[model samples]
Target: MIIELIVCFFATVSFGIIFSVPRNSLLLGGGIGSLAWAIYRLLPEYGVTSIFATSIASITAAMLAHFLARKYRIPATAFTIPGIIPLVPGSKAYYTMLAFVEGDYIGGLELGIVTMLQAGAIAAGIVFALAVFSFGKGIGHRYEGGR
Candidate 1:
């Protein structure tokens, strides 16, 4: 429980930094939501590993936020901050930046590759989300056509 809370807190803070959240409220709220999702994996049936599960969970939360923002008629970028809180890839990006700062060209190149991988992970998450969402849409359309 404690570990989860810490992860949530860190996730929120990371979200704030990533999305340029103006104050702590967005951070705290996003963190709490992300934490709730992380805790859900504690259930036996979820069969969740931290990497894949959290990626899916994070993207789900982000999509929910996207829907809400659309419903409320707000800028989608608003969701970018809190929505991306759980999966910001901060540590990897930071190390990549540090490598460049330290003048370690080879190390920087390696870190750059890791940074790209992290980006790919994020892109993969978005692609997976889109695929799931599209699959549901396809099923719905087929069912409606049958009617």
Candidate 2:
């Protein structure tokens, strides 16, 4: 578990560097990725399906990204894009393509569908987080206007 967290942190930081995220934000981005990956790894022990686990992990990352962005006065993407890297289904996508290359149409089709579903779950989680954040901001603004 410790090793996995370390790997997640480095992976996110590397991607952050590749993405040109500001030097000051790299550690926060790495921390977010590690936390999200921890959640993703632990959920399976409790019987959470991959799709649902990915969604929950993504939600975690997105929330952290928003908070970090506001705290640091930077765009959320600085954190989000790298934060979500640890949760990406890269191995599954690779296997999907491998199956196709091996002429296993049925296997490829199944993997492709699963890959798409996982991608959709990630997107749904992000959207859900954004909507909740926006709603909360709206309520805060409404009350602040009376001050």
Candidate 3:
């Protein structure tokens, strides 16, 4: 448990470095918590299905971060990208590139399709969350101009 927490902390710091997140600790802590939540879902009885779950969980965390940023007057992109990095389908992208480099055209094509699907899945999850949040915020609400 202690090791896992430490790993998550360092992973979060690495993400902060890679993404150029500001040194403020709250964003760093949020990244750690979000990543840890995804990794926690990556275990248990679900096995490989956990990857999909982690992707969805990261999207959810990104959405929550977006909301908090909006409510607290911070930059939205600052929270969204780092929060989602843990679940990015980077391995699949690398495999796709490797297949292409090895002259396995068919395998490369298949991997390309899989890579696009994974990207689409991640995008769909984020869009779904944003749509729901927007609907909840404005569905029946009146504007200051008087609806």
- How does each model score on lDDT? 0.59, 0.89, 0.64
Q: Write down the lDDT that model 2 would get.
A: 0.89
Compared with the true structure, model 2 gives a TM-score of 0.89
Q: Point to the candidate with the largest lDDT.
A: 2
Per-residue lDDT tens digits for candidate 2, residues 9-122, read 998999999999999999999999999899888998999998888899999999989888888999988988888888888899999999999999999999999899888888
Candidate 3 structure lDDT: 0.64
Work out how many backbone clashes candidate 2 has: 0
RMSD, one per candidate, in order: 6.9, 3.8, 3.9
Displacement of the residue 59 alpha carbon in candidate 3, Å = 3.0
- Quote the positional error of residue 103 for candidate 3 in Å: 1.7
- Candidate 3 structure quality by residue, lDDT tens digits, 29-140: 4554556455545554566554466556656766776686677676765666666665566787898899889998899888788677656756776677677666767656
Alpha-carbon runs more than 4 Å astray in model 3: 1-5, 25-51, 136-147
Could you arrange the candidates by lDDT from highest to lowest?
2, 3, 1
Q: Which 10-residue span in candidate 3 carries the lowest summed lDDT?
A: 36-45
Residue 146 lDDT in candidate 2: 46
Give the TM-score of each candidate: 0.50, 0.89, 0.68
